[model samples]
Target: MGWLKDDVALITGGGAGLGLALVHRFIDEGASVVVLERDANRADSLKRKFGEKIETVVGDVTSYEDNVKAVETAVERFGRLDTFVANAGVFDFFKPLSEFEGPEISAAFDELLSINVKGGLLGARAALDALIKSKGSMIFTVSNAGFYTGGGGPLYTASKHGLVGVVRQLAHELGPKVRVNGVAPGGMRTSLSGLKATNTADESLETMEGFEELIIGITPLRMSPTPDQYCGPYVLLASRENAAPMTGVVINTDGGLGVRGIMNVCGGEDLSA
Candidate 1:
C-alpha cells in the first residue's frame, strides 16, 4: 500500500517543474490531486494526462479567489482535502541588488514576493477550514536559498526566507489540527522562469549554461537531482502514518549542502582506497 492511500491533495503550480512531479508522485501513492495552474495549456495537458484521476483548475496562485477555488474543487470533487502544497513560484534569475535600478528593485521585489510568499499564504488560508476538519497538513516548497546564500538573488532568497516564517508560524497556530512544514530542494534543471519586472521573464534555468555541473560541483553529494527525486520527502510529510508528529519542520534535501566541508565539498572522495 502507498503511504498516501486515498488522500486528496491540492497543489498550486502543478502544471510544471517540481509541482508536476509532485502531482504524479501523489497519484502514484494512491492520492487524488487537484491542480491550481495559471497556464491554460498546462492545465489542459494535466486533464488529458490524468483524466478523472485528477482535477485541474485554471487560476493564479497570487489570487485569493483562485486559491479558494482550488480548495473548493478538491473538496467538491474528492470529498476532502488531505494536503495543500504551495508550489507555485518565480525566480529572480540571480540578479543582484547592485544590478537593478531603484524602481526596478522595488518592482522585482513586489512581483517575486507576491507570487512566492503571498501565494503560499493565500493557499494556506483557503485550505484552512477543510484541513482543520480533516486534520490535514500544509507543505510549502522552499528553496536552498531560504538558508544559505548564492542560491538566488536578494528577492528570491528573501521570499523563501519569508516562507520559512510562514511554515513555522502556521504550524504554531494550527497545532493538534493542521500541520505546516516546508521542503527545501537544491538546484535542479527545471524550466523555473524569472521575473518580468527584471526583464527576465523569458529566461529559464534550464537554459543556463553549466547549471547541472554547477550544482554537482558545489554540493557534497556530487549529483544533480531531478524533480521526481525530491518528491519522496513530500510523500513522507504528507503521509499521516509516517509524519504524525512532524510539524514546523523544513526538510533540506539539497545534496548535503549543510555538511559540506570548508576545504572540500565532500571528504570521502578517495575513501575507497
Candidate 2:
C-alpha cells in the first residue's frame, strides 16, 4: 500500500493484541515503527520478526520518562515521528458496580485509568514536538464503550469515554500543526487483560467464555472483527494524504454500534453473583 511510506510511528503496547496488529499493518504500508512495549519478551519478538523495520523500546506507558524514551527512539532510529498511537489498555472484566468494594473500586479505577487514559496523555505529550515538526497525527484506540454502554464495566467505560474527549481537545489545541483523531472499535477475541486490583490481571479476553457470542449478538453487524481488520482506520488517520483535512474526529469501527438500538450486554443477571 505504501500509504505511509517512510513515515515513522511510536505505538504503545505493541507487544500483543491490537497493538501488535497495528505494528504489522503499519510496516506493511511502508512505515517504520518504534514500539513501547513493557514486556521484554514481546519486545524481543518484534525485533526478530520485523528486523530493522521496527524499533522496540521496552518501557511502561505510565511513566513519562519511558514515554519520552519511546519518542526518542522513533526519531533517533527512524529520523522522524509521524504517528503516535496510544493503544495500551486494561479491561475491568465486565465487573459491575455491585461487584466491587469501596476501596477496591478506587484501586481498580486508579490502575485501569492510569494506563488507559493517563498513558495516552503522556504518550501524546512526549511525541508532541516530533508530530508538530512533521505535521503528523495521533490516533487513540478507543472502544465501543466510548460512545455507548455495555462494552465494559464502569471503570473501563469511563476511560474510553474520556479518550474521546482527549482526541477532541488535543485536536483542537494542536491543530494547524499536528492532527489528532481516534478509532473506536468493538469487542474482539484478543489478549485484553484486566486490572490486578480486581484480581483479574491474569484474566484475558481469550479465556472468557461466551464473549464472542455475546459480542456477535450485541453488534448489529453480527460479526466480531479481528485486530488486523481494525487497522485500516489507524492507517487512514495516519496517512497525511488521506486524512489531511480530518482532525478531532473519531472513526467508529464498532460493527454498526452507532445504529444498533438499546440493548443489554449481560441481560438481567445478578451482576454481584
Candidate 3:
C-alpha cells in the first residue's frame, strides 16, 4: 500500500508548475487532492485529467475565504483533510533592487508577499481545525532562494526567506497536534510567472533561454530537474509514519547548493578516474 493511502490533501496553485506535479504524485501515492487554482481553464483541465479522483477550486490563494472554501471542500468531499500544501508563489525574474523604482518595489513586494507569505498563513489558519483533528501536516513549497543568494532578486528572495520563518514559527505554534514543515527545491523549468506589479505576469521561466543550463551549471548535481522529480520530498514529508517527527524542518532539495566549492561547483568531477 502507498504511504498516504486514504489521505486527503488540499494544495494551493495546483493547476500548474510544481503544484500540478504534486497533485499527480499525491494521487499516485493514494491521496485524494483538492486544488485551489486561480485560473479557470487550468482548474477545468485538472478536473478533466483527474476526473472524480480530485476536486478543483477556482480561487486565488490570497483570499482567506477562498482558502476556507477549499478546506471545506476537502472535508466535505473526502471526509477529512490530512495535509495542506502551501505551494502558490511568483518569481521576480532576478530584477535587481536598483532596477525597481520607488513605487514599483513597494507594489511588487506587496503583490508577491501577499500570495507567497500571507496566503500560506491564511491557508494554515483555515486548515487548522481539520489538521489538528487528523494530526496532519502543512508543507510549504519553499525555494532555493529561501536560504541562498541570487536564486532570485531582492523582492523574491525576501518573500521566500520570510516563508522559511513562517515554517519554523508555525511548527512551534502548532506542534503537539499539527506538523508544519517545508521543502526548498532548486531551480526547475516551469511556467512559474512573475508579479504583475513588475510587469512580468506574462513572462515565464519555461520561455527563458538557457534556463536549464544555468541551473545545471550552478548545481553540483550537474542536472536540471523537472517538477515531478521534486514531488518525492513532499511525499515523504506528508506521510505520517515516515515523517512522524519531522516538524519544523525545511528539507533543502536544491541539488547540494550548500556544498558548492569555492573553486568548483562540484569537486569530484574526475570521480570516474
lDDT of 2 by residue, 1-273 (tens): 999999999999999999999999999999999999988999999999999999998889999999999999898888999999999999998899998987999999999999999999999999999998999999999999999887899999999999999999999999899999999999989989997899999999998999888877776677788999999999999999999999999999988877766643434332234
For all predicted structures, in order, the TM-scores are 0.97, 0.95, 0.97
Q: What would the C-alpha RMSD of candidate 2 be, to one decimal place?
A: 4.5
Q: Which pairs of residues have clashing backbones in candidate 1?
A: none
Between candidates 2 and 3, which one is better according to lDDT?
Answer: 3
- lDDT by residue for model 1 over 1-273, one digit each (tens)? 489999999999999999999999999999999999999999999999999889999999999999999999999999999999999999998889999987989889999999999999999999999999999999999999999989999999999999999999999999989989999999999989998888888899999999998888778778899999999999999998999999999999999888777744544463323
Steric clash pairs (candidate 2): none
In model 2, which runs have C-alpha deviations exceeding 4 angstroms? 262-273
Q: What TM value does model 2 have?
A: 0.95
Cα error of candidate 1 at position 8, Å: 0.5
Candidate 3 lDDT, 97-142, residue by residue in tens: 8999888888899999999999999999999999999999999999
* Model 3 lDDT, full chain set: 0.93
**Model 2 accuracy (lDDT, Cα):** 0.93
Query: By TM-score, is 1 or 2 better?
Result: 1
